[model samples]
Target: MGRLHSLRPAMTSTDLIVPDPVFRRVPAAFGLRWWMAGWRSFMQAPLPWLGLAVALLVLLWLLAELPMGGLLSQWLSLPLLAFGVIFAALLRKRAEQARAMTPQGMPVEPQNEGTLSSTTQRWTGRIGPLLLVSLLVLALGGVIGAVIVMGLGAMFGLGLASFGAFAKVMTPGVGMAAGLGALAGSLMTLLLLVLLALYLFSVAFWFVNTLVALGGVSPWNAVKLSVRAGFTNLAPITLFTVLLLPISIVAMLPFGLGLLVLFPVLSGASFASYHDVFGDEAAA
Candidate 1:
């Protein structure tokens, strides 16, 4: 009874996090590894992974019904993300068991469960910090949106002015050229803004959970470090999000069926990414 009970968290942040964590820059192509690891982890225990994904989806759905459910759900996602990391760790341990052999050619038993039991407690203990991080990230999103909107509006305004208003802009020659130029410029500006936000999300916000959960970082520090890490490894971050854009659309196409896999795979990816960026001494 005692041993079985110990399979979950005691809910302590200080005890679970690594002290003074270090981060390494990964190649642009390393994004492939993060997704690959996530995919592999999902395949390792498909049923349980899907079950967890279903639960998370339901939980978020329920949360969305509340007065400020969207905000609440954002805060809640961090701890849940940590749980995803724990599941990923479990999958890793299982893989280790299957491949590890003793000198006698017998499968060797793992000495202990690695980071599986304590991860839940770790993040729960840091819920306050996680909420703060959520707020911070959301606030940044708002600022980014506002700036992009202004830039776009200005762009369209200039186009209209140059073409001598709506009717003139639609005219056959000079107006048409001006209108097209303005349209192209507006589009280019919008694309740049979108990429900027994506860079931050991929480089900065995505890792906030692992930074706080596994690295034991404070909210402010985690944000700072995440942004810095993202900037240093912009290539991989850019590539990962570009590919993820389509996968995300596909995940949504099937009446959200893909979420059952997508959510869990994301958690695994988060786990894999954190370790890859910080797990190795080379990152140091």
Candidate 2:
């Protein structure tokens, strides 16, 4: 514990701006480090963490219930998630500090630093950066979505044209074969586009908000650094994403009750990965 605590850099004060955050490279297996750190963070204060997760889930659900709520929720999700990530970062720091303070003979105790209300109030000052990051994420995603839609639409049109040509061939068997081929081509095209969209959006959006909220990075700087960091750490991020698939499914299995635990775990994992890649130099 002492060894781990020692490696952490001193926490930056919230009031100071960190315009340029230093990035570090981590190993491919660092995905496991993220999950383990996340899990340990959850174990440290399971109850409060779970409670906060539940409250977050409930708040989102309620937001989604309002008129035009689906769109509103989508817009707000990133900003809100940044808020949660900030709180998780705080919890992580507090725990590490507590560990550092305990003597060799004493057990490290769980430190519950603040109520959710207090934490929320404390970080409201950073809402501008959080919301700015959120807006940029949505805008980039929107443009990507628009481009992909146009491309897919054109691809579908081509498939339909080929299918129509196949139908006019006058020979039943030939037409059927051609039609099937066209359909297959369309499906493959759709699959490829879907994957491309996911990859592009992931690179654009993954760590932008975290950089802004915790690192005090300006919005534009955060966006660039976030993408650079993504490419720089691609192997680790891919491994981390692959690991998420099964766990995410399992978390969804039980009326989503597992999300109370899983959400915070993922949050911790985000903060952990940030700490590893960006170091522990956070703005508060």
Q: Specify the highest-TM-score model's number.
A: 2
**Residue 77 alpha-carbon offset, candidate 2, angstroms:** 1.1
lDDT of 2 by residue, 148-197 (tens): 88988998998898788769975888888878877997899799879867
Q: Give the Å shift of residue 151 in candidate 1.
A: 3.2
List runs of model 1 lying over 4 Å from the truth. 1-19, 97-119, 165-181, 184-188, 280-284
Listed per candidate, the RMSD to the true structure in angstroms reads: 5.7, 3.6
The Cα local distance difference test for each model comes to 0.69, 0.76
Worst 10 residues of 1 by lDDT: 1-10
Instruction: Output the TM-score of candidate 1.
Output: 0.76
Q: What is the lDDT of candidate 1?
A: 0.69
TM-scores of all models? 0.76, 0.87
Candidate 1 local lDDT, 1-284, one digit each (tens):
00111122333546665355677777878888778888988877787778778888899899999999988897677777667876676566556655554455765544434444455555466667667777787788778778877977887677666656754536577667767777777778778877776666656676777776656577788888888876777777677778888999999999979888888788777777777776633111
**Residue 227 lDDT in model 1?**
80
